[model samples]
Target chain A: MERILAILVKDRSGVLTRVSGLFSRRGYNIQNIAVGRTVEPGVSRMTVTVDADPLTVEQIVKQLNKLIDVLKVSDLTDEPAVERELILVKVKAEPGRRSEIQQMADTFRAKIIDLSPDSMIIELTGSEQKLQAFLTMMQEFGIKEIACTGKISLLRGSKVTCDMKI
Target chain B: MRLTGAQMVLACLEAENVEVIFGFPGGAVLTLYDEIYKKGFKHILARHEQGAAHAADGYARASGKPGVVIATSGPGATNIVTGIATAYMDSVPLIAITGQVATPLIGSDAFQEADITGITLPITKNNYLVKDINELPFILKEAFHVANTGRKGPVLIDLPKDLQAQEGEFYYPETVEISSYKPVYEGHAGQIAKAADAIKKARRPLLYAGGGVISSGAHEELLQLSKMMSIPATLTMNGLGGVPYDYEYFLGMPGMHGTYAANNAINESDLLIAVGVRFDDRVTGKLEDFAPRAEIIHIDIDPAEIGKNISVQIPIVGDCKLVLKELLRRLQPVEKTNAKKWCANVLEWKTSKPLHYSQEPGDYLKPQFVIEEFYRLTEGNAIVATDVGQHQMWAVQYYRSQKPRTLISSGGLGTMGFGLPAAIGAQVAFPEKQVICFAGDGSFQMNSQELATAVHYNIPVKIAIINNKYLGMVRQWQELFYGSRYAHTSLDGSPDFVKLAEAYGAKGLRVAKAEETAATIKKALEIPGPVVIDFQVDPEENVLPMVPPGTSIVEMIGGE
Candidate 1:
């Protein structure tokens, strides 16, 4: 089973290592993770996707809560939430096939962010499935480089993970 | 008031009411040492950083106060790793202050530089690397708070050399409020009610206690609950003092080397009220078959520990004392004879297959006999710290601890070289109390240099070395299961411990026969200074009532 956890932590040095170190030490598998500052200063929110069974997911949440730097941990796997992942992909482009690549990018609502003499970088942000579909289409054209900001998520309604009492 | 970082550290310790520190001085900690020298702080210079850490841990275990230790950079910091992990595993409250290379040289691999905080991340409950002088006071105070708080464990604060010299305004915080670190102190009312109902329905209820009872000061509450409910009780090795060994229904330490009664009760119990326990594999052999018939209610301060190793029917995340008190309040007292049949059955097992060893006159002294004799001579009034190996198990079997913190041994980490330094720490904590370090020849030699520290401080700690000339625990396994191919288990040419003690300006004695064991211990007890006793025991003796690995507790192999 795949479970997503939204963790709020103090913005301090070594906080990342502490969080990741915990995952590795506990043998929890992290599928993907994205971290960035929240609305509050000196606080960061990390969205982590993990592959584990239901029991393991519960253990993961409890263990994450044990870290002193982590302020909050919410399993948004069963909650109604919005998730997105962004990818910057440079695809090999020739003069003849450029328009076809642009059409595919347009269909996926992606933008051609950077252009080179023989290649172009397309910026795309969407749910995991949409990103995967975009990548499959770009595979036809050689993907020269790829950078992904792993999935980041938030609850759909007024409910916020940080405000949820532990 | 304006104060240098070193002074600020002292201020925080003073604020926390730290009475003494176990530490060693080095180049990186020169500034802190200078402050200590000028300010006249109480410090015991240990021969090794590991000794200092264990000493601090022993002090903490004995005094119920978090112990403090200081070390220098690189090798010094790494030396305390085993000690830190030992405390972390046993849930001992300890604070380790390590001096790091100056901030400017931190990542450049400067002289004697090591990433102590990074290295200790997995071992420490929490740790900090002070990058700014202003954070020193708060970090030190927080280190103490975190170390002693719920599910107590070791916390480290790495101070850079330059920061220790930098002057800053010092204001120790009166309270710590880590948003991520709030501990639940009270169990849920509904859960307590449910547990009470379960207790009422249980005919063969058993109470299992662990180190948490000692850490939370819940021994009295645990005893009260057991008495009120007429329940049979068993203890983990770390929970030795949680219940007096002589209690009528108290089963001996339960695990691989557990007594016949303890293991049998755990196997047959209908309800297991496990408090302050983590269901360690040692305590729960072959987990799938452990207490198969029982419904377990686990109460611990740490939520993650509730169902960590074994499934729990009712999980309560709260202080053990508070939870036990609440359960006691909710349940009406049961009749004294409610579990008459069950209690009789347990007592029968206890008496039928009691712990025993046969040592004819003029035979090599049995380790068990020496411990039992010491226990009788001391009247079970002394605090006993033990080093790891077969001797540790033997002491655990024969020397029954009657009070919390009285049995100070490295339970979780099982680290060798813990006994002598730990006893020194305990002696330092209570100079008037009788503190004995029961060590093996192999274990004593690990941190044996600490006799110098003990002698210098006049800490009259007794060292009773069960000298078997081999790593008895490993040798036992080889003899039983490994075709008797004893690899490096032999301690072939270990130094004469008595000579080593005399060389360190401490008294020394040797007891090769069973007849001299009690007299030697009595004489050592009267020395009023540090003394070491080497008791030459049977080299191949094994701790019995043993449950082979991956087997059910009910299928124990020995002590029939």
Candidate 2:
């Protein structure tokens, strides 16, 4: 079981360490972490997704929120949220097959960032489900390399995290 | 008045209160050298750029600030790498400035060009290559900022030859905006409270301290908390002096070569409070058995350090300074002088062994006596750097570091060929303070090219070369348990150290008598420039209280 969490923390050295430390100590596999500044002064927003059951996620959220540098923390897995990930895929394509791969990429809505004589680099952005679908469709073109930014997320509704049910 | 990048080098240094520098000049950096002469600052010339870096490192550790070294491009720039890497591993703050080939020559691999910034990137906490003249001031400011802040480490600045020669106006800034560089200074209160509650409840509790306590200036806080809770203490190699060495509850060192009582105490403890230390392998022998029964309370400045090598029951991640202060605050109402019965047992252990070892007369020289005399002659005031080998072990075993930052060595890297140059940097960093290099005969040969650097700078550093006529440490291993099959351990064919020192224009001494040891060391320090004393003794002598490789704390040999 995997869950997403939103946390507001004061931007400081070792806060990420403390949060990640909590999960690791509990044997939780953290899949991704994205940190950025929030609208509130001195506050930074973080969305961390981890491969853990609801109880472990709840424990992590409770522990992270208790940190002096942490302003608030919540499990956003059940909430309406917009989640996205960016990926770069480089494929070893022959000159004869490059145009065919380009046509296939157009269907998946990925853009061609660079092209060499035998390689075509493509960039894609979407939810995990969408990425899986694109990867499955592009497998026919022979995927050679892949690198992804994990994920970054934001709440979908106008309601801030503080207004949601704790 | 506005100045050029070259001129600003000396100006910013002077502004930062840098009184002297240790470095070698070269062609690509001729402009930097030329600008150096424009103003009057003491610059010690070294034969090799490596010597300059060591001297700078030495000076920094002695003075408790960043040591500065300068070098030219390509070979000259690359030579100081060992010294920089040594500083990086030991967590010594040093500012290394190198001259690069012009910006255009970069990536083209022109004459005297090397990507020093790239080569040094991973080793340095932060590094910069000034391609634009306008960025020089900002770059320099950030270089110092990054060097001194958060876990203090070395920072390098590679100045392109064109940038050094360019006459663009320099405007040194007073500030920098690094949103990502902020370090957490406050400890989590809940964790502290929980740890304290655990400490108060623990009957067989242990408090372990490390170098981070000294770095964070939390020695007083540690003392206060320990005294308040009446906790027995153990110190890692870097953690010595976090509290008094003579305290009844103190376990001096706790692994491999740690005191018998300390290791035994750890094995028996029910709860352990580990603070300001990463459970390094040297401290925790065979992690599976280390503190097997004890529930661990780990307080660390870097959260990554907690449970890195050992599991933690209660984890507190915060700056040592901040966490210690919070602990002291919370334990304010508790009594400070309380004691328990375990304290009596530990005091007995401290006195019983105290590193008991003896030298049987043999062909190889004894390093222990040389270190003992080095400490005596200097009155424990000189800053010492050591190259890894038998001599390094002797230095640690025989000498006492009464204060923090007084002893600088390659703890993590265990790097050989570290002594001579690091001592030079130490001398240059603090010209007023004496620096000494405890080098093995074999290890010294590796970096002895810097002897020329010593003469050029005329730094009054003393080098005590323990000549055992063999790669003594390795030979000791071969002698002890390797069926006495000596391979390439013989160092007799190496360069004659006395002649080598004379060639570099420094005083050299070769003494075999124990009676002449103390007086000879005194004279070496009294003499001008750098001096190398080759102390020849029992080549067959071995460091005892030996914990054979991969063995646990319980398995100690030579105690019989």
Query: Which candidate comes out best when scored by TM-score?
Result: 1
Among the numbered candidates, top DockQ falls to 1
Which residue runs of candidate 1 sit more than 4 Å off their true CA positions? Answer: A164-166, B336-338
Per-candidate DockQ vs. reference: 0.68, 0.08
Give TM-scores of the second chain, every candidate.
0.99, 0.91
Give the lDDT of residue B116 in candidate 2: 84
Error of 1 at B333 (Å): 2.2
| Shift in Å, residue A90, candidate 2 | 13
Candidate 2 residue-wise lDDT, A46-120, digit = tens: 888888766556556654543445667778888898889998888878889888888878887999999988888
What would the per-residue lDDT of candidate 2 be over residues B312-425, giving only the tens digit for each residue? Answer: 889887778788787777764443232365555556666775666544454243567778778777777777788888887778667766666667777666767878877877
State the displacement of the C-alpha of residue B61, model 1, in Å, after optimal TM-score superposition: 0.4
What's the TM-score of every candidate structure?
Answer: 0.98, 0.79
Q: Please give the C-alpha DockQ score of model 1.
A: 0.68
